[model samples]
Target: MVQADERPASDTDLITLGRRIRHARTARGLTLDQLGERVGSAPSLLSLVENGRREPRLSLLRAIAEAVGVPLNDLLSTEPPSRRAALEIALDRAQRGPLFAALGLPALKPSQKLPIPVLEQLVGMHQELARREEEAIATPEEARRANTELRLERQARDNYFPQFETIAEDLVTRAGHTGGALTHRTVARIAEQLGFTLLHVEDLPRSARTVTDLRNGRIYLPPASTPGGHGLRSLALQAIAHRVLGHERPRSYGEFLRQRVEITYFAAACLVPRTQAVAFLEASKRERDLAVEDFRDAFGVTHEAAAMRLTNLATVHLGIPLHFLRVGDDGALFRGYANDGVPLPQDVTGAIEGQLVCRRWGAREAFARRDKASEYYQYTDTPAGTFWCSTQTGSGDAGAFSITVGVPYAHAKWFRGRDTPVRRASTCPDPSCCSRPSPDAAERWAASAWPSGRMHQQVLAALPRGAFPGVDDAEVYAFLDKHAPEQ
Candidate 1:
């Protein structure tokens, strides 16, 4: 679906579009031909317009409204923000098309004058109804369904794709960066071999770690601001995935995310070659519990990468069912991929990403350590089941982050820290998981808590809530801004 980033500031009036003529006509019990006769348009043509297959001339749309006994604006507006904004875009494009010329509709811009009452109705739709709709899901089950679908897709692969692994291995071998170590020099050589242009900008926006300017064919890398110096190569591979895999504009949010999953998997597989990684893991698992830091140290990758690589090995190589978590210092889960069918925290929209995880999990508790250099492991019992996890702390562009790899307690014997003295029990999804504020708990740590830690951010500059939930528009802005066509 086309993203609604181009919704004009002056076009806020178009938001409500509370009703569709199709809905109004169905309410009136009139057939398409009956309405077409009243509006002097063909039934087939009217159908095309309603389904977004054909654009109705402005005059024809007005006639359709008058025939249906609904205001013209009501016929044009849809309830969803993107749909309503798309109507405006469609109308603008239609006005500039050949059909409008044939119909003799006057040349007009989006700002051109129209009846004030129509304008007022548009404003009402844009302001009131759309705002309410934005905060909620059309169907509560939909959010849950979306998360389920993503989970199913992840399980479908069982966390391994030999096709992508083959591509990664082949690329690295051809670049002569095979065996022993995977370093920044290795990533650089592969990037140059792949003909990627890396540009480190003087004024790189701190808000974004990397930007892809496809227009200029340059990947903008953030400076040494991020602690791990491996971000540039990772970012370049991510950018390369779009072109390498011939990705197209996603028709839906899920499809967009699926593309992202494929890209990250490919990038990770490239950095930690399948043949080498599997061999290294086999040796490590046999020697002792597999330590993720050793994997990270071997491949100069981020802690998050090492965690993901562990899961990547589970299905084909390790025969272990694992779960991965990318938890932020603030307790938000940036990523959750599990093949074990364990219950993970989900946001209001039923997404694991961006959901606030239970504080007792190793991923969250690792952040509380006085000695972060030391590895942490937790044998935690949850309502779903017990999981043994290994967590390590890291600093990234998103601030302090935790990368964790966990397997069901039965499989813990295969991982490092499985026998560690650390342990915790969690009753999350039940209000008792230690999230809610209580008087006794507050008193004990009241002095230590930041008394004035509230950010109190201004909402004036924030982007409007659109179709997707938990999407940060600033990231979208950075991505699109970097990739927008050259003027």
Candidate 2:
């Protein structure tokens, strides 16, 4: 019988063996399906063995050798398992020191030898980590954190391996079984399904051919075009490989699995493009007012995706400072900040008195539109800023909502201490509000909410109907100027 480790003599030998298997099946006058049934496997599996899609398992080879009326040793004479090939590749990497150096990792000197046990230990540790990663499966909080980390790592590596563009294009071609060169129609179908377009793809120049280990997959592209070609390639490989190696595990370990997945390369590449998404965002004047829909149209992303991307954008990238706040009828406080990471003040001490913030803002605007006498009341009062522009949707009074970009005060304090006074009003405005301390104390604690952030803001500008306006540039500069770190 063939042993698992013995290598087949040559490609010719493997092909001859495949041919023998085919001849035996044919001689029996049994269809491939019938032969597959005898082996307790799929026809495709048997066919792949004959066509070399995979190396034949020793057990299968033994059975096939018997079925073919051949001596077991004849079938056993094949080469060692595929793992040997993988080992050889790993050794070659160890030899050049380029593998480590390319990844901006310390290179192992040629004179040094890695202890076999130590290497095994590292692999074992990876397996253990994989297990730990899977244990917390099904928790929404964990899933979200995993997704966020995957998005960040993938975005970073794709910036390095632009050649993976070719890999993606090739994958599309290989996906079809017909084995023809990829045609425009096929490419278009794949692109449309994936929601992306490959632009400015070109072949690597022959002079610069270099193979980079994208930790998960190998990328063969021209080298020396940029600093640390090998390093970038290795980083990209690792990012992708981490995802691939762990994908089979459950959601608890999804981050571990996804890290080995090669898809990270594509995601990262999409983000840090040759031109960058921020350039388009700036060109569109989005900093003035970050409307999720407007940004979505420009990037071809969903509204949520656009908003998240905006949160990641740096002022340096867009040449304009950006700030984001989450506001509701309750009031506005800092939810998050990007680029410079300005912390929203948690201690808001003051309250807006006698303000019909959410309810009367729109009515005041409509009334102002009809007559000059009512123009003074047109501005809606809120904690963030004057209501400049908005777009509303949903039905029933509570469903309608709007987002307004407000100018924050130079030293605005958004959060006040627990001891800070809350206005006298209902126990809890909405019974469904989970933030309420106790269900029993709901209605009695509801706040007579006013605009939360900069309560003093007066409406100097307003968006026309149907527009979701953003904070103005002058207002942003003023806010930043006031809050700028004192020299």
Candidate 3:
């Protein structure tokens, strides 16, 4: 396995790299001063780095790499002098183009920051080559021609897309919007929905600077931060917007480039809502019951959001029983719970199979039969045999009941269909083997653990609904107290 730190860096032609960085910086409308703030260097030093006049120290190079958003290898060449020298002249000349300079202030070499349309044409060439490769087995001549063309296109795109991120942002900001909502999941969904590919580069080797010449269907983003707080994301976003979105002509790249512009802070808030929920939870502790509807009203969120909030609330505060309460005559376990102070296993979300088994045995029966020596026990025989293993925690006022339960459900859904085999399905049929041993075993696992909404409603509907009224904490504690394990 290639450990990340040992991975070799980019070996792009250095002169080409200089031109690429200079062109990208200018296109983003950032002055030396503005860019300086991001990369943490004086404008003159930045100017020298862009012009290839100064050999940037490793520290400075890493910063510039992050600010320009190209990988370190993209900026500094590791290729042998013979190969690198041959490419440098063309790269340097290409960087001198007025089109590259027009995007911003000119640095020494400027021609290489070519138009996005040019890059797109190159991608079309690659696609054609790939298709042809399948038809004719490559002769020596054909293979050489194909390899040269692909390398040229890859280098061009690698140098330009970092600038595209900037252009995309400008267009979006101009249209009175921001990037998509910012949660791990929502950001992913939005990127896919917009036909944008997401790649994480924070784990790449030698900290190569990232580039995203979108015209070439390439995006480069750093895996982690460099000195001066510069990261691949900022650079990649800048490159994505400026290089990809700035075209005057109509193009397919713009569709992707424009999609990124639609991302907005408001949309992001809907996904995370951290600030809004934290405040509301802090205030709700004063209330006695902490009803879901009441939390919804207080937080100005939907009832479901309120339920989510309750689970989150426990992450911040301890000693609260604020469960996203779902009840039916069948049984009541936490659908969503926040214990506030409990330490628990991270993989508790899909522990319902175990709970169903315990419920089948009847809480009363499990408590009566609880024995430390008991290894295997039956919970139910009808419908399908249900099995359970039981465990308890603490004693006296601190005693807790834990029963691992399992019952047969439609295995097809678990496997996504009957045709496919189930993978890594949980094996917690034995009560003793169920429930990870952790203090927050209940709460940590409960957060986002339940399949609620429609599936939960179905589970509720299957039960005798009206048989159980909304029970109080005291009643709940009283019922459990009877079942509590003896000292």
Candidate 4:
């Protein structure tokens, strides 16, 4: 009987190795025989390796990479280097992991004789390479996935962080925000209470709204963020939230996103504390006109801030259920939160983070409104129910984004804009929604007038897969371990 080879090669390893060799060989425009001659191997063997028919040894792979004028790592790694470097990676990970806990021995790489620093450097290099691989893959999709997961987590917590709110309320009370509004005095007091010395630097980075130098306890604000009447009070609140929350480095990407949400929540809570906000809402709810602008005027905050704060009142105090939607200029729903069974557009996984909003909705309509100070009011009827939405569009840092506060028809009578003649029906899931083209458009303008807005995409040679697609599981585990706290 013929004895089968005991050390059989894996299908995955062979396929990955084969693709890498083929790509490198083709890039150099070298024939099979020409490359084989440089590698000191026969053309047939090289061809077999390229075709994934034969598993090449480390020596052969090294020679091939050298012949192709590339490093061994370049040829061996695909989208994920951590998995491709199997044996060395496993041993390297085990050394850092619980496997060698009792041994009290030093960690080792492929060459066990290498010293600790050398091994650490090698592992660090590997980690950097693996991160590069991950970046090369899932640039857009992974970001969207992170957003979707973040939204789900926030929803799980009911979009309200009680702990953060409690802390924010305490801070606000200590700062003496007895009045309903967060005046300049209260804002400055809040900053002083948080131990952050506020400074205004005009020449800060163009993208920088606020910068906190933790060591010196100084919060620098760029004037560009708030060029008009008052400065960025919300920015101050955000920086204060970062400090008072005592938030360390978040472990997972999800946790990092979660912390941002919590920080923002804390900031908003400080800006408009629930105790005062609820009292104001209760007072306003009694009036025939419940205006967000009225709330904005009374609180001395942004229209968007007033709108968002109203969403908190739904579950917290007033018991008026509502939904909030913030859409970009391009009709992308950037921030959306709903607790009143309002159906948000989502994927099969029930993720609404990156979904596009129907152009017919009030959120989209608000963008076209050139009057920056004016609010767009619309009573939209969807499959869910009739929602009365009032949105205010802003320019500058807003980037033409619209902030909307919507309530069900049953609750619309309490709002100010409910009586406005603006009304629209949006059957979002139906094919007819936003499908009809412009009535004034003609066949003559078809070729030249329409903007394609085409963007280039990098063509990946092949999509690679591993236990963790383009990521290192060990690195992720080690990170979570740090944030896990001592058991």
Candidate 5:
């Protein structure tokens, strides 16, 4: 019986072996006919094997090895016999690749007359084309899966990252920040310390929130007075954090999501330093008055940012497990994170974004309130457990949204809204739980109501294709070229 080593190797390995056999045959001063005659094979068959067009049987390989005066193991070696052989094998494999076949171009034959430079250039171009093809293949479903996986990973760590905290602390300290609002001046200092100059541009790319010119050591951002909800200090810090964290162009959607999480975490840490935020939260907990509004006011950041920052530090430092959610007015989830046992709605892909929130939850309930000026608080009882949440409503270019921070019932004593009487019961993941209409309502309107649905264009479209998805590469390049200073 044939041994495991006698089994045919993979196609790639066979290609390398074929090149080695050809090199050995020529070194032994034998033609294909002479070698094949010794191995009891036809010259045409030997030629096919030598050119990587066919695979030889193990017995035939052993016979050829003996005829060529080389060890059997030498014929099985993975490396090409020489640099020229390596280039030739690469060209052959590239031509066989799916990307090349998709182009419908005829394959080029590598010959002794082909110069090394031409082979190198051809191989390099094929490699680049393969990379671009890979980037173009990212789909919306792939992006959703990546987002789901990243959310689960962050949830495992209680949504906190100490490494980013340490980096932010060091940068803030060097910038001479002594707590309080973390003013724009201090953020600028941090950027300058990292060898970057912040430039407010009127013509920044529409798709980009901020752009970094690595060659010119510049960061371009929208003007401070611009109505976009993103804070100038936060945007600038996020851009600089990318450089500080040594981030590179993401090769996959998963890497891109991870890098975005890291940079945003770094910026949040800088905006609300861990040392200060932790101390404040600890004090609030001691007073049994932990409130997101106070946290937002103290840090001079937005309500959503403050609530998200709570998710980053509450469980890790304050010993309080909780959940955070950002829900749109239409009751669809935009973002969600939980270390507490509360169950959030998710689709088949395990993605929570764009999934409908239970109508009974605090996130959706807050949208019904007439008083948009004040925070809404509620207690929700779910299958997992009871949670008390505080939600704040805000509007942006996209529309209205509610940001909610919730803790399990047992941990509610440390928060301010624990005494509120508003409460709800939910049985989500069940079809009857806020998803189906009541018997009377369904009988009245289900048959007669024919509503037009607003289709989400992004859902039907493929994910943006490029190293940085959704960014217009041509516009960015043109902007840079126009603004680049003379050398």
Candidate 6:
């Protein structure tokens, strides 16, 4: 007695195998009935196998191969015998897939009269549908994991990307930026060089910072009077960076996060061209007067962007490993990166986003200062090692946040904030550090307090669905339709 092959095969694999068997039989000038007779099988049953409607037993496959004068391996090959057979197999698999069943569409039967172009078009549509469905269903956990992986990768490289630096330098040269802070006029020149026209629109999509109409060579941005208008140059450059980098629709959450990082780095590099920024940094280091505020002023960027740019250049160019953090007033870690062994709070997934930062760190302590006009500096002793940090407070629509940059105690001597008198010890990743209440306070308030917790909806929700996650496709399309000039 012979058994069917117990190993599971996908519908696609089985379909391809069946097509190969049929092709082999036909090539040998044998009809199904004649082949079935030789293999001791009925013609009708052989027809079912030939059509991919049934799985033939291993012994029967061997007999069929023998009767068709083809090697068993040839019949078992997964490749379709020809292009038409490949298209038929794809269509059949798509029809049997869950997406097709969910749509409740009538299946198209493959016949000699079905045009090859029609088959190609249908298969292409099905492939796109499958890709979009996958993109839509990426859960929050997947997004977190992807972000965590990206952070680790960037951290390993000290957040420095020389290729993006080269691209930015080239673009800046093309824009005629000879040095100093990259101005808005120069940024516009860069866009023009890239074949894009800058169009300030009041009705730009709320979810998007910048929208590029690739078809019409237009980039739409919020007017300069907007709250985030200070960063318009960076935003416009980020939009153009996508086109410059040849970014395609992301197939997974990881790819999206990667593209986001790449574009952000490119934008920052363009804002503070590497050669100029590094020279200024090297001078600051030599003077032992390195400061994020000065960097921000020189580059005409926000404190956060300056801090991030410092991380991008510190270890690679200045020979100093550093860490950067953006913490909310409520102590949540919005963004963090470190190459200097600074201990950052992270979940089991290694994600720092949304995790509550230690109150003892400079990022949180900066918020408590009465004078918000100046940067706050501190020395924090942690389980890993002591670190010196400088933090600056700023507010946006989402309320207050602190941007911080730090280095290990050894490297702190080169920074201006090294003389700060404020010092604190942090035992983070330990509940007692800042997470747990003090014994006296807990005894007094634990039984009396009944305050309702403020919830963050995004924490409990899945990542927004789309080719570019968090973007509304309908809104973007409608905006383009409303703004597109008559063609």
Best lDDT goes to which candidate? 5
Off by over 4 Å in 2: 1-136, 144-276, 285-293, 314-316, 319-487
Query: lDDT per residue, candidate 2, 375-415, as tens digits?
Result: 12122234434322222211234332233222222211211
**What TM-score against the true fold does each predicted structure earn?**
0.61, 0.27, 0.20, 0.65, 0.75, 0.74
Q: What residue runs in model 6 are displaced by over 4 Å at the alpha carbon?
A: 1-104, 107-138, 226-229, 444-448
Each model's lDDT: 0.70, 0.39, 0.38, 0.69, 0.90, 0.88
Candidate 4 matches the true fold with a TM-score of 0.65
Provide the lDDT at 105 for model 2.
47
Prediction 3 global C-alpha lDDT:
0.38
TM-score of 6: 0.74
Deviation in angstroms for 317 in model 5?
0.6
* Candidate 6 residue-wise lDDT, 1-487, digit = tens: 3235633234436778878887888789888888978989999988777778888777788788788888878777878989988998898899999889978889988654799999999999999998877765657777788888889999888898998999999999988999877888898999998899999999999988889999999999888874534388888999999999999988777788788999999999999999999999999999999999999988788888889999999999989999999899999999999999988889877889999999899999998899999999999999999999999999998999999999999999999979999999999989998899999999999999999888977777776676577889899999999999997
lDDT tens string, model 4, 1-487?
Answer: 3234333334346645666676677779998989988989899988777655688767677778888888977776654233333434434454554435535766543542555465566666656655644554444455557668776665554566677778888888998878766766677788887677777765444434565667557777656444433337777777677778887644444445556677777778877787777777888788857888988877777787778777766556766777888888877777888876667777776667657788778899877776778788998888998888888887656467888888888888988878878888888766568755555564557666868663425322322322233334454344334433354
Off by over 4 Å in 3: 1-272, 287-289, 318-350, 353-487
lDDT order of candidates, top first: 5, 6, 1, 4, 2, 3
lDDT of 3 by residue, 97-191 (tens): 54334448544422346444554454454445445333333233333343334323422332123233343334334433333222233333333
Summed backbone clashes in each candidate are 5, 53, 56, 0, 0, 0
Q: TM-score of the candidate numbered 5? A: 0.75
Candidate 5, lDDT over the whole model: 0.90
Worst 10 residues of 5 by lDDT: 3-12
Distance (Å) between predicted and true CA of 51, model 3?
Answer: 63
Tens digit of lDDT per residue, candidate 5, span 1-487?
Answer: 8776566655448788889999999999999989978999999998889888887878888899999999988988999999999999999999998779968999999877899999999999998998766654557787788889999999999998999999999999999999888877788899888889999989998878899999999999988784533498889998998899999888777788788999999999999999999999999999999999999999888999999999999998989999999999999999999989889899877899899999999999999899998889999999998999999999988999999999999999999989999999999989799888899999999889999998888887776666587788888898899888899
